[model samples]
Target: MASVKTTTLPGGIINRPGSTIDYKTGTWRVKRPVVNLDKCIGCLICWIYCPEPAIIKRDDGKIDFDYDYCKGCGICSLECPTKAIRIVEE
Candidate 1:
């Protein structure tokens, strides 16, 4: 097996009436992965397998991910043990 890596920087103009936040990753908004913190156990499994390393653990022990860098591949949602994540078509 081989590994594929991707990196992207966020770009956009300030609030100017409907200015689009340009995310270079082509799959932007392709799928929406919602994390259910209510069910999340802070296991960090989703964080480890996230190909883009988008998941970030806050100092308060909450988890969040950067959507701008997410490819929406659904791997994280699938790998979550507690069913803490789900992917919806966008």
Candidate 2:
């Protein structure tokens, strides 16, 4: 995938708000986050720390990642008490 040029991003009040959902920001990442479900305790820490709504709570009470907009920020991995989320090369 080609990099999204900074020039195309929102400028001084010139772009629409909440337009992030229109773009898959994860594509810009060099690394991605992988979740180890077995180690996950369903504590919701990852969900709480995620800047994006990438960590989703399932019907079963467990969580899953939404790679579509994750952006590989690693905040979830850092906040997970059980260290269930790991970062890997894309």
lDDT of each structure? 0.73, 0.81
- How many steric overlaps are in each model, in order? 0, 0
Error of 2 at 80 (Å): 0.5
Residue lDDT tens for model 2, 1-90? 233335654453436566556678766678888889899889998898898878889887788988878888899889999999999998
The candidate that achieves the highest lDDT relative to the unseen native structure: 2
Winning model by TM-score: 2
- Model 1, residue 72: distance off in Å is 0.3
TM-score of 1: 0.66
All candidates' TM-scores? 0.66, 0.75
RMSD of each predicted structure:
11.0, 4.1
